[model samples]
Target: MSQDRTGAGLGVDRQREDCEALAARNGWQVVETYSDNDVSAYSGKLRKGYRRMLADLDEGRATIVIAWHTDRLHRSPTELEEYINLCEQRGVTTQTVQAGALDLATPGGRLVARMLGNVARHESEHKGERVARARMQKAKAGEWGGGIRPFGWGVPTGETTKKVDRRTGEETEVPVLDMDKGVPEEFAAIDTGHDILLAGGSLNSWVKWLADKGITSTQGNPIGTTEARDILLRPRNAGIAVYKGEEVGRGNWEAAVSEPKHRAVVAILKDPSRRTTPGSEPKWFGSLIYRCGRPGCTAYAYVTQSGGRRYPSYRCQTNHGGGRHAQKLDDYVQDVIVERLSRNDAQDLLLPGPGDVDVAALQAESEAIRRRLTDLAGLFGAGQITMAQFTEGSDTARAQLEGVNKQLGRAATQDPLVPLVGAPDVRKAWDAMELSQQRSVLRELLEVTLLPPRQGRMPDGGYFDYDAIQFRWLRGPEPYYAK
Candidate 1:
C-alpha cells in the first residue's frame, strides 16, 4: 500500500518507487498497490488506501506492508494501536524506508511504534495550528490565500520579489498580485448583473440574461440558477475579504461591483418569496395573498400576460377561475388599507390576539416520523422489507411529516411588520419597504380574496369593477371592500 495526502510534485511517485525497491530487495512480490491522493491522514480525513491495506491484512492477504515513513502510515496514537492490534492478530509486519522495520509481534516494537505515533501527532497538530493562523493573517491583511478560483475572478498570477534575511543571508521570493487578476469579460458581466438587479431585475431574469449571453462559470460549465445567485452574493466580488464566513474587511483586489449595490442585491435575494425567473406578468402586487374567492375554492391566482403590455392579475389555477388587474386592484386596496391603519386606534391593529398555537407536540411528532422513515429505509436497504412496503411506509410517513411541518409554519408566523404599522407615518414606512416586505405586512394584516368576475364578463380589460377585491382581517372586525 502507498498513500500521499497531497499529490503535489513527484513526492507520491517517488514514495511508490522506493516501496517497490524495498520489496524487490527483500525478494517479496507486490500483489496489489493502493493509493489515496490529495487525502489527509492527520486531519481526521478518511484515507481509503490505508483502510484497504488494513482490510487486506485482516484477510491474511498481505504478510508485510511498506511505507515511506511511520508518519506516512500513522499519526494518531489510537489509530496506531488499532493497526498494531490488527497486525499482531494477522502476523503481519510493517517496514518504513526512513524508520526501519516495526515488529508488532514484540513488546519493544509496540513501544517504539507508540512513541513515533505520539511525535507524529504532536507535529501534525502544531502544523495545522500554524496553517490556520497563517490563513487568518492573510485574510486580515487582504491577501488571497491560494484556493479555488472565486467567481468573477481569474487565476491569480503576478511577480515575485526576492527579499534577503540579514542575519541568515538567506533569500526568499515573495509572491504578489500587483495588478488585478480578474478577467475583463467576467468582471463586466458581474457589473452588468449588479446593474440589472439594481434596476429591478429578478434572479430569474438575471440567469436568463446570463444564458442568452453565453456566460459560463469559472469551470466553463453553464452557470446554474443557484450558482448565479451565489456569485452575486459572494463578498469577494464586492472587494471584501471573508474568513470563516465572517467578513474581515476590504480586499486588495478591485471590486467587480460597488459595495452598496452588492448589499442591495443581497437584500433582494434574501427575500424568500422573490421569484427567480420573470413570471408571465412583470407586476405582481399583492401576490402574497391573492386567492380564489369562489365558494370552497382553495386555489391561488397566478400572473397572466396579455397583448403587448403585461397585465398583473391573480387567476385561479383550478377551474374556479377569477382574475383582477394587479395595478388597479392594488391601488384600490392600498387606499383602503392606508385609510384603515391611519385611524387614531391603528396601533391596536398591531396587537397580538390569543397566543400562537404551540407547535411543540407537532415538532416532536415530525421528528418521530423522520426516525421511523430512516428505520424503514435501513430495513429496505438490508432486504428485510419488500419494496412495496418500504414505499408505502415512506410515503405515509412523509405525508404526516409534511402536514406537521405546515402546521408548524403557521404556528411560527409572526407579524414582524407590527413595528412598522405602529409607526407615526405608517403609510410612509410601508411605502419605503420592498414589495416582499409589503407582502409580509399584508399577510399579517388580512387574507386577500379575488372573487370570479360576473358571469360572461371577461376577467381581463380596463373595465373590471373594484368589488372583486376583498380583505378579511385576522384581528380587526369584518372584511374591507375596495370600493
Candidate 2:
C-alpha cells in the first residue's frame, strides 16, 4: 500500500513514483493506495485517509505500508509509537523510500525501525532549535525575518534589487499607494512603486485604506482595523526582532518602513490625555514617610485636612482602633519636628555611611560565573559530558550570574547618590527636592512617630513642652523646612 498526499512536498510525489517503479521491478503486486490532499503533517489530529488506513490495517485489508519517510507516517512520538504497536499487533510490514523496510514480526527489524524513528525525532528537535536560533539572530541584525510587507511597501521582485533609481535619484522599490481601488484622476500617472499615498497616516486611515483595497491577508481573512494597526506597528517590518522585550536589528533584511515613521503612527493612536494630568496637592513632610510602627497596624501613614485648610496633619490610618481618629495640624506639628531635627546631629543618622556594598566583591563574583559557564561549554565540546550534564552545569552558572548581575546593578545605582548623602549641603539638597522626592529621602532616613496631644497645665505655665513630645527616633529623624 502507498500513502501519498498532495501539498506535502515534491519529495513525497517523487518518492511515490519511485516506490511504484521499484514495486514493478520487484514484481510485487499493488494492493491499495491512499491519498490525502491539503493536509498538514505538523498537526496529525485529523486525516480522513489516515484514519481509513488504520481501519484497513486493523481488518487485515492492508499488509504493507510505505511512505517517503518516517516523518510522513507520524510526526509526534506518541502517534509514532501507536502506529508501531498497531503494526506489531497486525503483523504488517512498513517501508519508506528514504529509510528502507521494517517487519514488525521480526525483532531485528523492529529494532531498526525504533532507531530510525528516534533519529527522525532528534532531527525534528534539532531543526526546530536551528530555526529558532536563526530567527533570533536575524531579529538582532534588524531584518524583516518573514511576513507580508506592511502598507506603503511591497516585497521586491525580480530586477527590483536596487532601492534607489540611478537616473531619477528616487526610490525604485514598490510602494503601496492608496489601498483603495479606483485610482483618482490626479494619481493615475503617479508611480505607486515610488510614492505611498498614506504618508504620516493614522491607524484609522490605514484601516479605511485596507477596506477600500479589497486586499486580504495571506490567511484569506478580511483585514480588521486592529489587524491593520498591528501590521503597521510590528517591529518585524522594520527589520528588528522583538524577543523577551528586547529589540534586535537584523543586518541583511530590508525594512518595509522606518522606526520614526512607525513611532509617528503610534503617536496618533495614543490617547491625547496620556501625558497630561492634574498634579496632586502637597502633603505634610512625613505624611507617608514611614510604615505604621504599631506591630498589628495594617493601615499606612496618611494626611488629614480639617477646618478649611487650618489643620493638616500626618497620622497612622489605624491609630485608634480603626474608627477612632486623631487630628494633628500640619503647621503646628511640622514646625516642632523641623526644629528638633535641625538642632540635633541628624545627618549622621540619616546618610548611609561607607561599607554598604563591596564593588570589588560583586565584580569578582560576576567574573567567576562567566568562567564557570566557559568551562562547562568547553567540557561539553570535548566529549567529556552529555547534553544533560552541560544543561545542569549551565543552569547553576546562570543562577550565579543573575545573583552577581543584581549586586552589580545595585552597586552601580548606589555610586551616583552615595557621595551626596554626607555632604555639608545635604540639608539644602533635601529641602530643594520636590515633595515626592523629599518623602522618598525621608522614608529612606527615618522611622517617625505621632505623639498624643498633651493634657493641660505645665508647672512652668508653658502651653506645650517640646521635650515631652515622646517621639522615638528610629534612624536620624531629619526634618526639612522651606526656606
Candidate 3:
C-alpha cells in the first residue's frame, strides 16, 4: 500500500484495509505488509518499503503483489517497465481492490500497466505546474512561499505542516511560517554584516564572529563564508520579492535594511574585481593601512624580512626609506583607535546613515532637479528662449541636479564604523577583532603615513620619531597627533 499526500488521495491506512479485505475474500493468507506513506511514487524520492517488497518478490518470499491500484504502485513509465520485468521473472500475480487482478506473466498485462503509468505521470505533471504558478503569484505579491521560516522575518501567519517519520510511521505537527513573530537578534545580525562589509571587512570575518556568538543558520548549520554572504545578499532582506530565482517586485513584509545599503553591498559583492584568491587574506593588521611617506612615493607599507631579528618589520613596498617594527606599529594604531572609540562622541566620527538623512527627500529633490532640466530643454526646442539663455539655464539646472545626486549617493554609502561606535571596554573590543576587521577600522578612521628614517643616529639603533609618522583624520578634525 502507498499514499503520496493527504487530501484528494486516499490514506495509506485505507488502502491497506481495502487490500486486506480483497485478500480475505480470495482466502489468501497475509504474509507481510509494506507501505510508503506520504511518499510520492512519481517524485523519484527513495522508498524503502517499496524496495523491500521488490526484494521479497525476487527471493520468492511472495508469489503475488497486492495494491489498491496499479497507479499507486507505479507512476513513472520507466518504473512501471522495471516492475513489469521483475514480476515476469517471479511470475508474481498482482491483485488490487479497485482494479482487477493483473497477470504480468503475459504481454497484455505489462501493456496495461505501462498505459496506466503514463496517465498517472501526466496528472502529476499538471499538478506540479499548477503549484508552481500559485507560488509565483504569491511571491509577486510579496507573500511568503510557505516553507521553513526565513531567518529574520516571520512567515505567513499560522502556517503549520505535518512531518511524517518514515521509520515509525508517526506524524509530527510543525509550524512552517509565523509572519507575526520576528527574530530581532537575527535582524540585527544581518545589519551588522552589512555594516562590516561596507567597512571593508570580509565575509570570512563575519562568519568567525557569528560562530563565536554561538549563532548558526536558520537551518541549524554552521554559517560559513558563502552562507553568511548569501544571507546578507538576499533580495528579500531589502523587502524585494523574488520568484523562480529572479526578483519580481517589492515584498509585503518590512525590509530589514535600507534600499541604499542593500544596493551598495550588492555592488561590492558582484564587482568583477572582488578577490577570490584562497588564503590571500591579510595577516598583518597594518599591512596596507599605512602608506610610505617618502616624497612623491605612493607605496603601501608591508611585512618584510627583519635580518634574523625575532620581531617582524614593515617597510615601504616600493623600497622607499620608511619602515617600522610590525607589532609595535600595530599596537600604536590600535591604541589610537581604541582611545577614539572610548570617547563620548565616538559615534559622531561615522558618516551619516539613513537615520541622519531623509533619503526620500533627497531622492525627490534629485528627481525634481532632473525634471527642471527636461523643462529647460523643452523651452529651448520650442524657441521660447534665446540660445544663450537656454545654455545658461540648462547648465544651472544640470549643476543643481549633480549636487542633489551626490547627496543621494552619499545617503546609500554610509561610513563603516558601526562595530566600534560604542563599546564599554574599547581596548578589549579592539583586541577581539580580526586582523582584517582591525585593518578595515583603521582605514575608515585615519591614515598612517610612515615617514623617512632619522637623518642622524645617536644610539646603537636609531630612535624612532613618533612625529615623523604623520596621522591624518578622515572623518573629523585632526587631533594633536594627527596634526
Candidate 4:
C-alpha cells in the first residue's frame, strides 16, 4: 500500500522510487502497488484503490502490505480496528517504508498501531480546525480566499519570480500572478443579460445570442438560460460580499451591474404573484386554461394587444381565431365551481378514500430511496458506475420518492371545504378564500373551456355569452352548464 494522496503533483514519483528501492534492499519482490491520488484517509470518503488493496489482503492474493507511512494507510481508529480484525483473521503483516517495520502478528505491534492511528486522527482534525479559522478570518477581512473562480474575476496565477536577498546578494523564488483575458467579457455579459431581462427579452433568445457571440460560462461551455439568470441574480456581481448566504458588506471588486438591477431581477424571479408577463398571469394558467373551444380548433389562446389596451382574452396563437374576454369566462366558470363544491356530496370527493396506508412506512421508504440515489452519485464519483447507469438509477429512485411524497402531502392536507360546506354562509366562506386557494379548489374539480366570440354588438360582458364557458367536472357529477 504505497498511498500518497496529496503532494503527489510535487513528489509522488519520487515516493514510488523510494518504495521500490526499500523493497529491493529487503530482498522482497514488490508483487503489487496500490495508491489513492488526492484521497483522504480520515475524511470517511470512499477510497477505491485502498479498498482494492484490502480486498486483496483478505482473499489471500497478498499477505504483506507496505505503505509510505502509517497515516497514509489508517488515520481512523474505527478503520484501524476493522483492518486489525481482518489481519488477525488472515495471517497478514504490515510495514511502512518511512517508519521501518510493523509486526502486527504480536500484541505489542498492535498496541503501537492503535497509538499511531489516534495521533494521526488528532492531527487531521486539528489541521481542519486551523484551516477553517483561517478561512473565516480571511472572509471577515473581505479578502478573496480563493475558490471556484468567480465568473467576472481573474483566475489566480503563481510563478517563481526572483527576489534579491539583501545580505547574501542572491536571488530567491517568489510567487507572482497572471490574470485570464475572459474577465472583461464576463463583466460585459452581466450588463447584457441585465438589459435583456429588463427589456422583456426571452431567456432562450438571450442564451442563443450569448453563444453566437462566444460568451460562455466559467466552465467554458456555452451558457444556459438558468446559468445566465444565476449570474444576474448573484449579489456578488454587483460588488456585495456575502458570507453564509447573507450579504455581510461591500466587496473589494468593481460592481458588474448596479445594485438596483440585481435586486430587480431577483425580485421578479422570486415574486409569488409574478407571471410570465409582467402584469398578467402565467400562460399555463391564464385564459389558456380555458382553451379555445371553437369547433375543430385545437390551439390554446395566447394573450394579445390592440389599440394600446391589453385584453385578458384568449385567441388561438397558432390559428389566430376564437378570441374571447378571459374575465367573463373565468367568472362564469369559477362561480359555478364554488356552488358545486358547497354541496354536502363534495365532502367525500375531497376526503381521502379508504385504503391501507401507513404514513410512517411510506416516509421511511422515501428516505431509503433518497439514500440510494446518494449512493448512486458516490458510485459515479468513484468510477464504479457509468454516468448513464447513474442517471437512470437516480431518476427512477427520484420518481418513486416523488410519488411517495405526493401521497404523504395528500394524506396530510385537511379538507378546507369541510367547514365551508357545513357553514350557513357558504357563499361568504367562498368569497373570503384567497384567489390562489379558490383557483386550487376549482382546478381539483373541473377543466374549463372557452367558446369563440359571437359576431354581433358587444353585450354587457362583451360579445361572448356566459354559455361560451364549459366545465368538465372531475368529481361529483358530469359536465355542469352555468346557464
Candidate 5:
C-alpha cells in the first residue's frame, strides 16, 4: 500500500494522515510514498513522481497501490480509467483506506471498481458545482465569502468573550463587542481583524507582534507575512464570503472592524506600486496582449522601459537582450487592428463557420424545450401530477431548456455579424461583462504572439509594426501555443 500525496490541500492532508495512521494500526505495510506538489489533478499532465510510479508498475516494481481514497489517486474520470487499465494489465491491486480494495481482474470486481471511481469523480465535480453555486448566491447577495481573516478581525464564534493579552503579555478575558456599538457584548464580534492589524504597521511587524503574544492560527502555525497579507486582502474578513473566486454576502460572524476599513485596505493593496512600496513606473498595458514576430524571438511581446519613457517593446527573454525591438503606439494602432479584425471580412475568421451550427434547427429545438417546460408547469398547476412527479418532470424540462438557451446564447454571441456589424454595441457589451467574461472573450478571439518589430520602411516612409499581435485566424501556433 502506498500514498500519492500530490496536490492535496491542508484539510485533505489531515484526512490522509488520519487514514494512514488508521492503516498503520491495522498492520498494513506502507510500501512506498509518492508525493507531487502543485500539480493539477484536472489535467493529470504526468507529474514527475506519478509518471515514475506508472513506469515502476509496468516494470513489476509494486503490485499494490494504496491511497487514502480513490480521489487521492485521480480526480478526472478519464485519468481514472487509464490508471485502472494500467493496473489491470499489470495485475496490480489498489487498496484505498476508505473504499477498501479495488481489483480489476474479475468482471464483477471491475464493475465495482469503475462504479467507485465514477462515484469519486462525480462527487468531486458535484462538490465544485456546489461551491460555485454557493459563491454565486453569496455574490448576488453582496456578502463576503471565504478567505483568510483580516488583521483587526477575529473569527466570530458563538462565545461572548475570548482570552486576550496586551502588548505587555498581561492576559485577560476581553469582552467582544459589535462594531456599530462601543459597548461590550456577550457575543463574539466579527470584523476584518487582519486589516486593522495591517493598517497599523508592516505585515512583518504584525507577525512579530502576534508571535510575541503567543498567537497562532488554528493550525498552530505562527502568523507570518504571507498569512498577514492574505488576511488583510481577503474579502471574507470584510464580512463577505467568496467562493470559487466570486465575492458573496457577509457571513453571520460578528464584525471586528467596519466594512469601510476593509475597503480602504483593499484599495491600497490593489495598487501594485503602493503594495510594493517605492512607487514603480506605471504598467498601463501590463496584462494587455502582445504577439511575437522576431525570427528567433519566441518570447511574448510586451511594453518595456526606454529612456524614462514607456513604449510598446518586444524583447525575447529566451534570447539575449540584443533581440529587443520597439513599436510606436499611435492613435490609430489599436483602433485600426481592432477594426480590421472586426470587419465583416474578418468575421468568419473570428467566429465558427455556418457548417459549425444549424441556426434553424437550434431555434426549433429551443422552442420545443421551452414548450415542454411550459407543459410541465401547467401539469403541476393543474394538479394532474403529484408534486414529486411534477418536480422531476419540470427539472428535466428546465435542464433541457437551459441547455438550449446556452447553445443559442453561444451562437448569438459568436455570430460574425454580432462583432463586425455591431462593433460599437459589441464593444459596449464587452465593457459591461465581468472581468472573467472579458478573459473568456479574449481567449476566444485571439491567438496572440510577440514578434520582433519590423525594420523596413513602407512606401509612405512610415514603418508600422506591433511588438505583439494576434495571429487573427489561426487556432494556435505550433509548439509555442500548445494548450
Candidate 6:
C-alpha cells in the first residue's frame, strides 16, 4: 500500500502498476489487489486494504501476498511479528517488487525480515523527530502548520516545490501552508461574532445568525454552538501563534479581532453562567436576569406560571417568598429604555466623550494581568504553589482584569446601543431589535430588582407593586422608575 497523492493528485496508482507488473512477471496468479492510497503504515493509521488482505489470508482465500516493497507491507517489528504469525498459520509467503521475498517459513529469513523492519522503524522515528522539530521552528516563526483549513482564515493557494534528496537523489514533495493570506468574508464573520458575544448575545443566537447568513464552517457544514465558540475564541483570531496547544508568539497573518476584544470574548465564552442553548431563544425581558430583592437574597428570578397566579410572575428561584407581575415589570422597563434612547442628550449621556479613559493603556494592563493569571495557574498546576496562594493570586488578577474590562468597555467595546443613542426614530429602531437584543439593551442600561411583597394588599388587588419593582440605572440617564 502507498500513502499520499502525488503533485498531480494521483494516489498510489504508480506503486500499484509496478506491483502488478512484478506479479505478472513472476507468473503469480494474483487473487485480489489491495491498495490503500493516501494512507501511511508508519504512522499506524488504519490501512483498510492491508487489513482486508490479512483477512483474505486468514480465511484461506489467498496463499501469497505481493506488494510494492517490504516496508509498505510491514510496519514496525512488532507489527511484523504479528504478520509472521498470521502468515505461518495460513501457510503464506510475501513478495515485494524491490525487496524480493519475505520468507516467514524459515528462521534465518524471519531474522532478516525482522532486522529490516527494525531498521525501517528506526528511520520512521528519526523522521518523526525531524518533522516535529521543523514544525516547532515554523510555529516559532509564525508559519501555519499544514492541515484542514481553519475557519476565519484564508484558503491556502500555494504549494511546495519538489526537492532533491541528498542521499538517494530522489525528488520529494513538501507541503506548504499559505494560510497567512486574508479572506474578507471570513474576517468579517469573526468580527461580527465577537461583537455579538461582547454585546451579551448568547452563543446559540450567534449560531442561528450564522445559519441565517448562510455562513457554514470551513468544512461547509452548519457551524455548531461549540465550534462557533471555539472558532471565535481561537488565538489565531488575534494573530497569536500556537504550537502543540501552547501559544508561541504573534502570527504573520492579520488579526481578525483586536487583542482586547479577543480576551474579552474568551472570558465571555468561558463564563459558566452564560446561556448555551443551541436553538432556544429567550421569551421574557427580565426572566432570570432581574435579581431578587428579597432583603437578604440575591439569586436570579425566573417567571413562573404556577402557584395559582393568574399571570406569570418573576419569582425568586431560591424559594424566596417574592415575585412581581412579569408583564407590568417588563412594560415599565421597555418604556424607560425607549424614552431615554430617543432623547437628543442620549449621545452625551450614553457614549464616552473625547477625554475618556485610555483604551491602549487599559488594553496593555488587561494583557499583563491575564499573563500573570496564566503564570500563576501554571505554578499551581505544577504543585509549586499552595491552593491558598493560587486562589489569592488568581482572585487579585481577575479583580484587576475586571476593573480593566470595565474601563475597556466604557472606551467603546461593550456598548451595543451606540447606534441608537441619537437615532431619528429610536422607538422604531428599538422595536425592530430582536428580543435577545432588547434584553441586552435593558441589561446594559438598567438593573431590575424585584422587591418582596408589601405587608398590606393593594387597593386594586394586583400583586405587582410599582414601588416594589426597584429599577436602578446602570448607565446613561437615570429614568424615573424609583419610588
lDDT of each: 0.71, 0.52, 0.76, 0.66, 0.52, 0.77
Return the top candidate by TM-score: 6
Q: On residues 346-399, what C-alpha lDDT tens digit does candidate 2 reach at each position?
A: 445534533566766765665566657767877998989999999999898788
Cα misplacement distance, residue 204 of candidate 3 (Å): 4.8
lDDT by residue for model 3 (1-483), tens: 334543333477788889999999898989999978777888899889989999898999988788999877988887787888888788888988877888787778777777777888898899889989899789867888876567787654567888766556578887766653457778888888887777677888788778888888788889987778788878788776777665556778878887667767776677677776666677888886688898898989888766675667888887655447787777777777788778888877877555676778865665566557657767988999889998898789778855654554456664556767787787877777667667767877888888876665535565545566788777765453532
lDDT of 5 by residue, 143-196 (tens): 544444333444344456544232233445554433322212211222323333
Q: Work out the TM-score per prediction.
A: 0.60, 0.42, 0.65, 0.55, 0.33, 0.73
Per-residue alpha-carbon lDDT of model 4 for 369-415, expressed as tens digits?
75686588789999999999999998898789657745654443334
Q: What order do you get sorting by TM-score, best first?
A: 6, 3, 1, 4, 2, 5
- lDDT per residue as tens, model 6, 86-165: 99999998888888988989999899899888887787888889989899789868888877779877654567767555
The residue-by-residue lDDT of candidate 1 on 1-483, one tens digit each, is 223223342467688899999999999999888776556667678888889889988999989899889988888877898999998898999998889999889999999999999998898899888989899789867787775566666544666766555335466885643334677888888887776655444555667778889988867788867788889888788677778885556679878875545655676577677655644533465653677888998877766654443665556777445346667777777777777777776766765632564555764675578668768978998999999999999899888865664565444233545546557887786676555445555666767888756654445554776656667776565454434
Q: By the TM-score metric, which is better: model 1 or model 2? A: 1
The total of clashing pairs for model 3 equals 1
lDDT of 4: 0.66
Alpha carbon deviation, residue 288, candidate 3 (Å):
6.5
Instruction: Enumerate residue pairs that collide in model 3.
Output: 155-179
Best by lDDT: 6
Give the winner by lDDT: 1 or 3.
Answer: 3
- Global local distance difference test of model 3: 0.76
lDDT-sorted candidate list, best first: 6, 3, 1, 4, 5, 2
Query: On TM-score, who's better, 1 or 5?
Result: 1
The global Cα lDDT (0 to 1) of model 2 is: 0.52
lDDT, residue 72, model 6? 82
Error (Å) of candidate 6 at residue 323 is 8.3
